[model samples]
Target: MAQPRRRATPTKRDLLRADLRRSTPEELSHALQMLLDQSRLSRDERLHALASALVVEALAPYWVGDRTPNQAHDALCADDEELARVIEALAPMLLGHIEVREEARDAVATIEAMLGF
Candidate 1:
């Protein structure tokens, strides 16, 4: 008798893609429109958006109902010094998002490369 083969576990990316495939046409259209809008944003604006997304993910464990991701980003931006510090701290994590690592590039540059902008 042949031994049974085990199935490979699904990765987060695989699961996400599967879920996306099941989305309604309207939902897919809305998602596509949002991506298109993001692509149209200026470099600075797109950098801000990427930083906000990073902050949102990092802060999710501590996020409360009253504080939204945009609100959290706004509060962080209000303190320019702190914002710089936060960006510096988040810079190492940005490495995982991009394919190639360039020496001495800032977070904005890394994000631009990640986004292909």
Candidate 2:
């Protein structure tokens, strides 16, 4: 009997790309706003949304291949000066919205360090 091949588990980047493909512009905008301002979402949720939006919406168009969020961040910092400037401009808003939650603090710090914030 022939067995079906099992699909590999989706990575976080895959999930984010899927979500971005599924979302409308309005929906993505609303989610971005929710992440930017105070919302019911936990800090972790907000951070996830931020990474998803930034990587999928902002960077993916310019990016050629699949990349994890961290990889994308590193690429932008190392190779893409224009995109790095864009992220720098956005840093203040993200920094302002940042909440000091124990669960998300390390993730936030990692992202901030990557962005040179």
Candidate 3:
């Protein structure tokens, strides 16, 4: 009989969040510490939203392809204004296509409801 393949283990981030939901102090602290690493952002929600936006942006390369597409994101992070614009423009559309978590959905909404569009 053929057997099903085992799924990949959840990431540390996922484990951390799970621990948070369980009210485990160590896990909660780890999650907070992780967010603290990105303290430049005004809120964790904003960071969460940007993280969601980035996953959406990342998938663009598959559709954007190597057909003379912009290479800025590949070259350097935050050096691609056009990519940012395109990501912002296409975020809503991308949201429908992805199977993101509620947190990620909220993050996407955060980006959408920002000062601009």
TM-score, every prediction: 0.28, 0.28, 0.21
| Candidate order, lDDT descending | 2, 1, 3
Candidate 3: residue 29 Cα off by (Å): 12
Task: Point out the worst 10-residue segment of candidate 3 by lDDT.
Answer: 67-76
Against the reference, the lDDT scores of all candidates come to 0.59, 0.64, 0.57
Q: Ranking by TM-score, best first?
A: 2, 1, 3
- What is the lDDT for 55 in model 3? 56
For candidate 2, give the lDDT.
Answer: 0.64
lDDT per residue for candidate 3 within 12-116, as digits (tens), equals 566555545666777665565565554555564455566675755564554364533345344423555576665656556546535466678888889988956
Query: What value of lDDT does candidate 3 attain over all alpha carbons?
Result: 0.57
lDDT string, candidate 2, 1-117, tens digits: 999975455444444454656799887775455435545676766776676567455666446577766676677778778877777677655655554455488888899999999
By the TM-score metric, which is better: model 2 or model 3?
A: 2
Provide the lowest-lDDT 10-residue window in model 1.
Answer: 95-104
